[model samples]
Target: MSLRWRITLAIALVSTLVALALSLTVHFAYAYRQAEQARQLQTQRLELALEEYDRTGQPGLRSQLNDPKLPDRLREAASEGGTAAMVTQTPQGAVVWAALSTTGGDTLSLRSSYQPQLDDRASLDRVLLMGAAALIATGTGAGVVIGARLSRRLRHAAAAAARVADGDYSTRVSAAVGGRSRDEAAELAQAVDAMSSALQNRLQAERQVTADIAHELRTPLTGLTTAAELLPEGRSTELVRGRIAVLRDLVEDVLEVARLDTATELPELSDIAVGDFVTRRVATYSSEPEVRVATETVVATDPRRLERVLANLVSNAYNHGRPPVVVEVDGPRVRVRDHGPGFPDEVLAEGPGRFRKGSGGGHGLGLTIAVGQARVLGARLSFTNADADGGAVAVLELPVSEGEDAPGR
Candidate 1:
């Protein structure tokens, strides 16, 4: 059940228990008081009967002389020259009896019908039941109101947290103005806002450091590249050129990551067919991958960014995975699969991190760049191992514009 319903039911259960306890108490108390009053009235009638019998040698009207139906306990008490009263339940109803010993050695007994008191008690019970029902109903309604308010506040906090997770650092949760006293929901909202602020600052600092380092190296890197290019043609010189190229590429990847982190690279959205785009990009690779088009689907996205993402995936697959790489385009979804060892457990779990290379080594920035570019293009990219084929697959799903017909629609 949702938190709202749970809270509502909890309040309703408490209300039910309280109402039941109160109803029982009032029912028993009222019955006891009525019994007591009946006993008192019976005792008064017995006293008057005894007075009349002593003066006129005859019991008063409606009073019995040595009544056989009198309770044994009352009769025994009267025989001992003591007055006693008791209310006993009979087949008819409750009967309150009073008895005493007269001068003639006769037991004087009087009783009053308790049916009226019982009737009143029944009426009371009905009222109490109705009142308890009303109380519970009112409590349930109040619970619904309280639960809705709490649920709404919690939803606001959750939404803000989601936005923060999605890299919207400006999103913050705050309690509503004139809301109820500072509660847990308010505390949660405040905590989310604080966490977002801290995370935003930390990410900004990391991006700044990455950008600064990349900028500082770029000048020396250009000079070195120019000088290396001028250094003849030999195996040793080729090796030097290869190492320099790798270093330059690493610097460029870092710069790209910094730009992505700072959200400075925005997508230039345009209509593109997924099949054609994948085929064209795959042709540009050093070792061309097999391209398969299941259905030609068009999507609105940044073709340049999408190509960059696809390039990284294809490159990563070639460098780290066994050939022959395959790129499949199905509707707006593109899947690049390489027949090699799947991604590492950590990579699959927490995604690719910069400088964190896998078993088959590369700078590890390929997948990271792909993920960043996918995010900029508002696309969903996921990495997984093919269950049957036992190879790594990177899937990128680009969002189609609204009102546009899907493939085969």
Candidate 2:
């Protein structure tokens, strides 16, 4: 059951048990009081009966003893030489009877009918029962009200959490949900709000630094590349030019990654055949990699970003793993796998992050950029070691396209 129902039932049960205990206490106390009053009246009647027995002797006493006014229980007590008392319900309401033996051979008995004490006790029982019912009803109502309020507050917190998980750093638990209440739920809301704020600030700072670094490196890199090109043609000059080109590419990649981080690079989605797209992207690679088209399917995606993702995967495979680098498209998904000592355990387990690369790996932003681009397109990018070939595989599952035509159509 939900928290609301659990709390409601718990409160009702506890309140009912408490009410029952109190009602029982009152009921027993009233009964005891009525019994004491009956005993006292019986004692007085016994004294009066003994006096009458001494004065009138057996004849008048016998008539009094056999009086119809007395109850059966009292008559028995008086005739036998012992004490007895009983309360019985009659058409005229409840009556109390008591009897005792006198010093003489006769017995004394008393019948107190229309006794409010006994009758009041019965009335009190009805009141107690009614009061208990009222208390349980009141408690259950209160519990439901309190539980619903608490559940709403908890749901608000949960919604805020979901927004944050979806990369919406601007979302926060609102003050109206609690309105300055310093309860535990309020504390949780406060904590989530603080966490989202901190993440937004941190990401903003990281994005700024990345943009600044990339901007700062571009001018010097251009000058270096021009200076290298102007040098005399020789082995040394060739090495220098190649190194400058690598540095230029690195700076460009950094800027691209920064753009991806800030979500500034919006995908220009278009309808394209999955097989043709993968084939065209793989054809650009210098390695002339093999391609497998398992099924012809169309997809809606940003051609430029998708090509960039495929290019990076192909480059990483050739640079870091044994070739026969293959690109495979099955339906709306593509896989780039290389027959090399798969991905290092750490990278596969912890996922690809900026500056986290394996031995002999490029500047670690490649896979990170791929992941960001995949996320922007509402796709899933996953890395795993292939089971049969024991090679690293990067699988990108793209969003479904609007078109359903086959490839080359």
- Candidate 1, run of 10 with poorest lDDT: 172-181
Task: Output the TM-score of candidate 2.
Answer: 0.75
Runs of candidate 2 with Cα error greater than 4 angstroms are 1-6, 37-101, 104-134, 175-184, 233-235, 288-290, 317-326, 338-350, 385-390, 401-409
Q: What lDDT does model 1 reach?
A: 0.87
**Model 2 lDDT tens row, 8-65:** 9999999999999999999998788777777677566656665667686642323345
The best candidate in terms of TM-score: 1
TM match of model 1 to true structure = 0.95
Per residue, candidate 1 scores C-alpha lDDT tens digits across 1-409 of: 8888988999999999999999999999998898887878788878988888889998895889988899999899889987888889999778888999988788999977878888999999999999999999999999999998888878777877887788877776774312766877777778778878888888888889989999999999999999998999999999999999999999999999999987667888888888988898788777999999988987888988998999889888988899989999889989999999888888899998888887777788999999999989989999999898788999998888787647776
Model 1 backbone overlap count: 0
Pick the lDDT winner: 1
| Model 2 lDDT, full chain set | 0.79
Displacement of residue 185 (Cα, Å) in model 1 is 1.5
